[model samples]
Target: MQRTADRLLREPLDCYDDGAIEEGDLSVIRLALEQFHHAVADRRAVIGTGSTDIPPMQARQT
Candidate 1:
């Protein structure tokens, strides 16, 4: 979970260089945002603040 958060919140910075972003970087950013949204939804459900329709994110096996 922590790994996922780090990837979503921090890793994207690596995609930037000299204040410019590339197409591949945009794809990475999109995926990270989508995963982050799922994480938030999962947390909300766990705390009874959201519906269960949103499936929980699976931890990646590193």
Candidate 2:
């Protein structure tokens, strides 16, 4: 899934550099993004939120 996400990101830029993208290409790009979204959600579930490890920010006086 990570590889798919990387490919979708890199290939489209390469395609745009070469020439204009067609409807078919746009459809594939959209689908790839949807798949990547799901992949990220799955990863987040496995990793859980690490927010608790971060220290609270202190406000600075002007």
Candidate 3:
């Protein structure tokens, strides 16, 4: 999954503008990428824990 995230981050921004995406479309893409980055970070944090260690809870208090 990190590999996929790397690919996403490395991809050319021009690719997203190929069809003249509207402002709303660009916003959506930005949000998606941000979410993807967060998920990748969370996955890495979990995997960094040693086999004998428990993964940390990630829930936020409201």
Summarize candidate 2's per-residue lDDT along 27-54 as a digit string, tens digits. 6666656666666666767789433232
For residues 25-60, what per-residue lDDT tens digits would candidate 3 score against the true structure?
556556666676667666768889423333353322
Error of 3 at 20 (Å): 2.4
Error of 3 at 16 (Å): 5.9
Q: For candidate 3, what is the lDDT? A: 0.54
Clashes (N, CA, C under 3 Å) per candidate: 0, 0, 0
Q: Model 2 clash tally?
A: 0
lDDT preference between candidates 1 and 3, better one: 1
Candidate 3 residue 11 Cα shift, in angstroms, is 9.7
Cα lDDT of model 1 by residue, 6-62, tens digit: 666554455454345554665666576677677877888889985646555453332
Q: Assess candidate 2 and give its lDDT.
A: 0.59
Could you tell me which residue pairs clash in candidate 1? none
> Could you tell which candidate, 2 or 3, scores higher by lDDT?
2
Root-mean-square deviation per candidate? 9.4, 11.3, 9.5
lDDT winner among the candidates?
A: 1
Candidate 2 wrongly placed segments (more than 4 Å): 1-19, 50-62
Lowest summed lDDT window (length 10), candidate 3: 53-62
> For candidate 1, what is the lDDT?
0.61
